[model samples]
Target: MQQFIVTPEVRFLHVVTEPSLRLAVLEHISAGEQHSDNHAPFFVLETPTWDGEGEWSGRAEELRADYEELRAVLAQDVRGVSLPAIWKAPSGARELTRFCLELSEMLRRLSVSPFDGAVLVLAPVEVREPERWVSELKTLLALEELRKARLMVVEVDGSHSEALAVALAQEALRVDARPDEGQLREDMATMLAGMAAAPAGVTGAQVVGAAGPRGVSPPAKKTQARLSGEQRESLARELKMAPALFDPSFQQALRLKVFAAAHAMREGKSTEAIKGQREARDLCLDAGLNREAVILELVLGGYVLQAKQAPLALEVFCDARKRAEAHELAELAVQAQLSAASTLLMLQRFESAALAYAEAGKLGLVASQPLLAIEGYRMCGQVLARAGNVAEATAAWRKALEVTRSATADERTASSAPEVARQLAALCRKHGLKAQAESLEAQAVALEEPPLRQTQGA
Candidate 1:
């Protein structure tokens, strides 16, 4: 394999059948990059500006421009280096003129600071025109300068049928990497994500006539913080998450084991606690105690979290949520749902987390749990805001405030109402919603007023 310093054969493909493989494939690519000095020998583009389950905004022509962000990323090698931007493609060019010019210009940039090829992963939310995008990419890859550049399109959850169709169109080169939970925890905990590389070997340029725009000065380098599972899952614990919404059908012996597990947790014997709860959970299921089993599973999730195994905790919470719903354990469903969603947020899968939060909020509403409903909606706003959906975020926060206000007579609900109103008010002020902000602020004060005094004023 080391016959040459670099492998020249480049390819484009998808690994959509298993979402877990997305990161596995990324790891494989990173392993290859370990041999190169370039900081960003690869880039992943999954987020989209347009709104579709995939890419569909009716402006297909603007698709190429949509990825202009890539140019700055790849153009990193030319930054502050002596290179002629002499091969600039005409801004007005169209069709073959555009493609040819772009290819030619990219080749020129490659000469002074030649990148040893790149892996470009286009994990779009969805790809509406797989063939069209592929065809466009082929035109770019046709040039030898880009010989090592490859495209890998992926959808992490395998939720899209287009992924399968896209794979069939090509002779499938299967990526066989599988998920290892413990390994994923360790890997993510210490992972150092790569980005744009600074150029080397270029000194100063000899101007033929004049200098071109000082070729894109590199952006300040920032490092991504390592994600650790060891962080406390304090968010869920504080929520006073309920056990399964069911009458306890515990055998005397099984209840003893459950108590022992709780005792173990208090003693900091997380592993023992987790094992005990799992046993209790299984026993409950075997004894036709589906709701009781779910309760035990929920207990087990906390044990898993305490042991600093958040990935496994998330899985347990998700599994419990599904089962809780099936058993119509509304209260427990909201608990498990929010836990699973928050874990996703910690994992930095923003879109999935946002959707999960929305589901949890809606479920909380259905369950008539005002505090849980407010929390779910509030966090959904937070996740949406983090994902750059300000409008949606505002709406979510608004919904949370509404829920809080409607249930203010309840002690727990009233206690949290002012804070919820202030949160929405802050968001409103940030986005210049002055009237809304003022209204929310007034409501926040009114919420804090004693019920008798408030009624007299009204």
Candidate 2:
């Protein structure tokens, strides 16, 4: 097999039907011929066979064992902390996105660790959605921490090879497996020369601005004349009264009333907004629209929170949460619990806030919303820290990290656990828990990549 020197900047490589190529790459990385840092971790995601079972299963197990052996060898022989290899089957759609997201998050965490080394990702041959996979890979590449991560895609039976090549043309290079010894040597030497010639500080730029991953464009600025306070009040009154005339049968009218109340609040009419929200909530309840009633209650809770009535907000949010749970509205229940937790925090009920946050996180996890769960745990840590319970705070933060790490295969946490660790570390340092602070700081570093420092030597 031909061997090429692996550079830190090499992000993508495509091998054509060469299973041993992964071993060769690992060997080169372990040798540390092109970099000074220790060999990093390896995470392998193999695509499941078409039937989802059969001979490929045993083959996959064998490959996984081989990867484990390779990891052991690197750890022992090369004196590197080669973390365990992660093997995953090719999950379609949501699963694929989750896989990519998890890998990206892992790479990000690895980048900040003491090792500060590269990661190798071995992809499956028959990627279900090549274009989408490539797109996600591009997104991962755009992440700062994952810049040193490399992807190796092995093409089997020429499956989507051409399409994959085109999609990843800018980021990946084709690797020739059957090259002659002379050709292989030349390839390695050329790669080394290219790495040496490459600029150290090459940066990427965003070509287009977007509001979210779905490519939704930002709303255009409104050019209409702004309504005066009196006009707004008049509109609010009209909306509130309009719902009553139709015997409150139109949910849209009630919704409009809620919107008017929001507008009034934004216009600084807090008293009027509170009154409007109460009236709306009562109307929704009277109409037997429990879901709508819960929403209105949440709005009222927000108004109370804005008015600095933390106690009232807590009550309202708690009621909303109960109503949402009774209605089997998981999303609304999670939101209400989070709102109640915030109110508790505002009121300096630290222990209660922590409990509420934990409850919210549990609800989020049960609802399969990993981001919400992560936020909840993160808040729990903050509240504990504020209450002068460093140990408990650290525990909560660790729980958050665990949740992030063990998030469902289809869930995305957006790296919230690392943020929690970072914040907790800062809090620990502030509180003079030197030993704890150091430990947390190291965990934070392992969980997140700090901004790169400019060293004179480099």
Candidate 3:
């Protein structure tokens, strides 16, 4: 005999770039049923139109026909189904209030319960007065009868979907229905070229001249090498000559701007570094270079931190982290998280700083950057210790030491494992972990030993 299992909470998600929002809805429904042990009732409520501009009569008729089709389709596969409701989204505040009252009554009558399983709601895109509509919907969903119902809303991106999703639901999931990678790359390249060409201050020839021979060709692939002093001077000169060429819309421009910013930072010209970074960040956003924008924002945040504006720096770094996560740039996201944690430490928000550092360490491990993870754990320990959390701080540093010791010999050398061990030993000794301190000191000494010289037998 199968026992019925009821899901306790409602779920909300946004299908980004999905015009129909059908796949996401259906997938959730199928998953819900598949996971349950017994048969459960399911309901679906769809909205008439995203924008409340069309004729009410015509839109209602269309919605009715669509609902019938959907109900018939669900009837074939799904059991214990109830008639779906169509929400006539209102335009004005007064109408919206009245509509909410009516909807609340309808939901109460539905008697939705945990055993009733999932209730999928297809929301309209291009909603007018989204704030009011979302507020009303939230009230309706909060009714006791609908409390256990798995309420899911499918919404399109760029229609204030995030704002609506956050207001109406506890969790929001993003489904990226972007075009194929090749096509996306082509589109981005085209857009960037157009933006680069449209700016009036710099001609292509001038840009090419300022960028030197490298600008005439497609931008060079990114390398790990640091620029020489001469190269930095050349980049700074070119950037000064054609300031517009520093826009991130052009790869050459982005490279030049990065070099120029680095040079300014090295030269202690914080204002110039911030200005160039801000301009590059705006250009990256415009060009859909989200990852690049996140990196530039981090750079800008570092400058803000240097200026001793910890609050503003934290805000900027948090924004960068959000952007990086949204764009699925894991490495950059970890970097931003670490920067934000550092700013929190500066502001003496010790608990939050520790949590942020811990989160960054976990994310760094996930992103396969063990060195970053080590640094994060180290910072977490430092912050915790400063907050007088001695035991936890010792634990964090010990974890850092453990991670450092686990690395390969070459990786340990590359990542400065000796320095990490020494730091841990100092912390352990300070906290009265004499045995742990001795162990860490031994590890540090071993790490510091020079590699044996290879000799050919004579």
Candidate 4:
């Protein structure tokens, strides 16, 4: 005999009515779903309280607890939620029309997912407009088809509307923005009183989101590193992956991975650092980032690897070179050549190193990197001198000296000029060009003058 087990479908839901506050709530939920390990069913109903007063009815307690727990976990204090707005009101706040389209879209999404619970909270700052929001909430409550789903209504105290100003705040899911508890209590009192005096059949809890919890308070604030708007937008941009190909949580995981890698690099953990760097590139690519962005990441990875494994660094540089060439990324190609040159020099391959330096110089010149171009010449001189090619070395030094002299008037002297001159002088003496050697020395001395001294001399 076999026993049959039934898994009751669980759906979590939240509705926010405040305009300013809903952005934070939406952000939190989006971030959580994109990052959280839990796979439980949760649906959020987000909107501005159309006017100010709205009747709400639903299975309330369940909604409140689920939201409070979520807020507590995300350490909600750091990131302010964001919402869309089409225009600003006379008071400089967002007008309600912008939220209407978003609200309609959200409702459509919720209807597609069966057994998904939802929460709706309304925060209307315009005290005089409560009746309009009340009407909107009433419309939401009339949908009996979602009878099993939970709902909640949060009314902000009109006095502190500045603090409690939107649907997410109306929902009170997380505590990023809040006022005194007494202020909230007063708002709740006004809401209850207004509901009691409403017309028959269109009255309390009947016109708002399905009633769930009432007079609930938000969690206390906590200390955590919060993300700025740029970070949130960047994270959101990363989260636009195909629903089937990669889990939404990949965005959050990638963020954590980036942080870990940066920390590892700071701690001098080369292996872990390299691992993190690779992970960021993989994640970014998976998220459909452009080739330029990915190459920038690869460049950073190469730098980290070079600090630990010179051989691996060269391999990374080669990979970067191929990718940059294919994508026409001239700057990245130059960076790759520079890295390759350094790696070859590290391996004591003077000829190969000189060729790498030459490649770098060509790329640098193409990319308008004057300083790098000068250094490239100096490196060629060193490698040639080291290879016992005195004539060629002296010529390379002379070219570098020419560039240094030309740049002296531009205030962009290459720091390596003096060293290049010394090397060139040595090469000149070896090749029996002592005058040329002394001429290079004098040029180096004149260019080495402090910027202030240079200005005075000029």
Candidate 5:
């Protein structure tokens, strides 16, 4: 059980448990069911105060800060799960909506089990109406990710309103509980069993799930499966459902625009998506989310590229590279350069692409991202070689070789080292660098050849 789980996102539950024993129950859930010896749970427990004169609704950014901080902790633990070799932490600061969307994306991408994770939030229902308050929390607070990846249990002292429970039927479980640790534990065990049996049915007062039996379960993929288009819209729609009250401010408006743009993209409405993203980017700048604003340039560039506006895409990516550099966002800077390089290639500007990739490689090295550095330099050499720039190609490949040497102990090293050496060796031989070519050939062989197997059967 990883700390992160995916099922229904948020569930409101009130069940019997001793005050003394609630902490223990939380710890149990946080640890997750004992799936394996190496399993780690990524649980976040938040207890927010409600003292300020402003409505919790009004403190959107502050609440976002707390949620994102908890998410950042989860992000670190998420790395322990299986992921691509070159994955990194989610990029820098974002507005509340983008932050929540990113957190949801990261959790969904990284989680291995369904609803095996929990977020235990202990706080008073803040708004005048309990239903409205929870709604705001889900949307405004960006706890919306609770639907697909994990169970969010917001425990309150008083009974929740009937209207609220009814409105969230199937999504929440509100139990009439008293202090009985033993009974609570038994119930939880039963609930967890129900969840494992039918994770798709997450929240109910009776059990986690109670469904008719099915055929033999298929083997789960090592990676999270891609959500279908409908599923993606369902996820996006959750964020787009933020309360109308959230629309007054620039930040919230931008949030809606971004969400709309995203859904449009997923629905294959490119024109609308581009228009919405463009508007959202300007709103980000107006709202003072500078890093996010620059990030949107990257997004707009991608959208433009997809729409077959290669020249405009090149311009946008180039602008993004400059913006990222000015903001000192090294990773985004590398991404911008790489994006521009690819766009340049699409436009048959091979020389410019080579220059861009080389620049990205230099930036990647500066950012301590050896994988990106290796990729950029490798591509630079390839593009240069194809264009018949033998000397420049040799220099780029040699630099890539140096980067691989330093990254030898990295997980990506084995796959990368041999390829870089072999390519460099081929180019070296072509250029008549005989001794260098021979040494590179030996290096490539040493890296690629496997140890001999000892066999008894002849």
Candidate 6:
């Protein structure tokens, strides 16, 4: 068997099967797809007993005829081929063209599908013309329909299957590099299953533009990573495997431990807190604990803000704010906004902070956190006033006072209104307008209607 990497978007798997051709199919196909996404050509001309469960049995010559029949079906340039079922086929030029054309269409679709996908093709190992497969595939894919796509090709031989197995391990690295947690996990699972059946050794695995650097396995553990027997067993249980099957757990635990080590980096422990937070977030996603993740993100956002990294801090808090809005955590969203605004303030981006604070105030009011609402309102007013928009500032402060008053009943003390009024009064006085300050003070007292009096009779 031989492996070839043609383009980033395309992969070709070539193998030689004499008496039986099932090895190539079993080497690649798994439950990840209803069928393999490899749109490339697979040929098993001479094979027997390829289908164990089905009645699809044929001699080598019969299988070759079947392969040609499939080639005829997909020989069209537009409509694509489904992953071909293993069968016998004799070779022909026209049949190969038809097969390549259809297979080409299938490859084109995989590139743009919503889910990341792959293609697998298996054929009888020996062929009259191996170049025919490659040329036909390239021509079919070069059509306007698939001009910009990527492809990868792998060929296998009995002696090289072992090397192929090691090369297949690179799939883990590809998945691990993905930033999206859900996608990463899905890729990891699929790759693992693929690796489970891939041949153990091959001459070389050519991964086109992808498959990353050749021979790079998942990152090696920096130090001796130890796990208690019980912990190992627990992890195996989570993965739904027996204790004896611990390789996957080792990788998962390493990833988690790397994140955990980040937490106590300063103390020289193995883990990092940021990594832990990220893993926790990923865990939340896996468990469908969205609310928990959102809340945790809010806390993490605050921590970033406190660390005084203004830009990075804003990104975190803004994400939290968006999540809060989605979950209807209006109060929490307001808090996130306030935190973001403060970070902006520290950066001397006063106008931006003022706008953020205004948004926080609005959300706080709607969330019924009147005191916080008022405080935000006051801050925005002050910001506007300092920016020299006296009228807008005054309006903002008045709106803040109204919100505070409306939060209370006549019998309830005017919470925060007095302090706000005094602040407004002083601002008004500073503008050399005693009458406006007096009016504000009067409104504060008058809010209680001065207790209905019997003096009307007098």
Evaluated with TM-score, which candidate comes out highest? 3
lDDT for each residue of candidate 2 in 1-458, tens digit (9 for 90 to 100): 12222444455666654544645644443343224333454434443333222213222332334344444554564434454455453443233344444445445444433434444444553555555545555665676745666655555434344455566556566754543656655544443333333332211211111112233322434873444556645765777543233331244445446755776676668888898899999887776667778988998999988987788888899999989989798988999999999888888877888999999889988987777888898899878877778888888777777776666533432456645765665566566666785465455434433222111110
Candidate 5 lDDT over residue span 1-458, tens digit each: 23222333335443334354455655555444333432223333232323322233222222333334433444466344233222232443333344355445444543553323324343333223556545544563335454433333434444444345556666555544355546645554454454445423122331233453433333445684545546655765687532322222333355456766765675578899899999988876665556787898899999989989999999899888887888688888888888999999899989888998999889988987777788889889889988988789878887877776556453343445555676786566566786886587567545543322111110
Q: What is the TM-score of candidate 5?
A: 0.42
Candidate 2 off by > 4 Å: 1-249, 406-415, 424-458
| Model 5 stretches with alpha carbons more than 4 Å out | 1-256, 411-417, 428-458
Give the Cα lDDT of each candidate: 0.57, 0.59, 0.58, 0.49, 0.57, 0.50
Q: Which is superior by lDDT, 3 or 4?
A: 3
Provide C-alpha RMSD values for all models, in order.
Answer: 22.7, 22.8, 26.0, 31.5, 26.8, 31.7
**Each prediction's TM-score versus the true structure:** 0.42, 0.41, 0.43, 0.41, 0.42, 0.37
Cα TM-score of candidate 3: 0.43
For 1-458, candidate 6 gives per-residue lDDT tens digits of 22232233323232322223344344433222233332333332222122121111112222234334444544452545333443322233233344444434444443432323323333333323344444444553455654433232323333222233234343211111113546745554444434333332211221111233344444435683544679868987798655533444433433343333333332333224455555666555454445666766765665455455579878988988898888788877888888888888888898888888888789878988876677777788878877888887788788788786557564223344544565586577677787886676555444333222111000
Superior by lDDT: candidate 1 or candidate 2: 2
lDDT for each residue of candidate 4 in 29-109, tens digit (9 for 90 to 100): 444433223222343332223322111211121122333334343333344322122122122222233233333333333
> What would the per-residue lDDT of candidate 1 be over residues 1-458, giving only the tens digit for each residue?
12112424325554554554565665555454445434223444443323221122111112222223334334453344333433433565544445445544544443444453445556654455555655555565566655555555555543333444345454223343446556754433232110011121111221111222343433333672322232223422454332221222233346456766776676678888898899999987876668878888988987898888889999999999989989889999998998888888877888888888888888888998888887888888888877789888888877877776456465442445555566676677667787886687667555554322000000
What's the distance in Å from true for residue 67, model 4? 71
Instruction: For model 3, state the Cα shift of residue 391 in Å.
Output: 0.8
Candidate 1 stretches with Cα past 4 Å from truth are 1-251, 404-408, 411-415, 449-458
